[model samples]
Target: MSKLRNGFIVLLAVFGFAFGSLSSVSTEAQPVRTAEAATTAQQITKINSTLSAKNKAAKKWIAMRESGRSYTAKNGNCYGRYQLLRSYLHYNYTKVNQEKTANKYVAGRYGSWTKAKSFWLSHHWY
Candidate 1:
């Protein structure tokens, strides 16, 4: 009985409890929704106001292809406006986080959004 109790405790530790039961330990995986619509022009203009001419154009072009500038877009393991890998966003899907994370990712991976756009154009993925 003590061995079984210990094993159950380990299981609980491995999978956190919510409402006294495993919240994320479902038997089936939930499907991720595909992108439905592009972000509104007002939102794009607002975000673009923070960038330079070339960068703004590149960013918008990349976003149009990747996730239509929609912060909620998800394709497979990628998520958010830039379609960054899920691990990169850490499941935080707020617009601010998405923007920050995309800039950071682009900076690290391709040095700038313009370069990323160029790469995306060449390979059809970036």
Candidate 2:
């Protein structure tokens, strides 16, 4: 009975050690994920800041009216913050691509986000 008790104690210690090592590995991984998230957020902030204040405000207004800044927002054939036609994206739907494509489309079709917003205000779409 003493030998059995010792064996059980050894088994519990082995399991405890294995679990401790696994938890430590996961804890070490957490910082890398957090750092990556912070880097991505910083990049997004930089990209957003590139616009002039007026253009940024117009863009935000349109985004709010269209999709409320949701990256995955969809309505019929439109998608993303700008409510762009899915065909316009050629299936590339990353946030960066969405921003770039929206900028180009707004520039091409309306000359600026401000103009697009005006059009939306008058006609309910842009």
Per-model C-alpha lDDT, please? 0.78, 0.90
Q: What is the lDDT of residue 26 in candidate 2?
A: 100
Model 2 Cα lDDT, one tens digit per residue, 44-118: 677777688999999999999999889899899999988999999877888877888888899899998899999
Off by over 4 Å in 2: 1-19, 35-39, 42-49
Model 1 root-mean-square deviation: 14.1
Candidate 2 Cα RMSD after full superposition onto the native fold (Å): 2.9
Model 1 CA deviation exceeding 4 Å by range = 1-50
For residue 22, what is the lDDT in candidate 1?
Answer: 44
Q: Looking at model 1, which ten-residue stretch has the lowest summed lDDT?
A: 28-37
- Cα lDDT of model 2 overall? 0.90
lDDT of 1: 0.78
**Most accurate candidate by lDDT:** 2
- Pairs in clash, predicted candidate 2: none
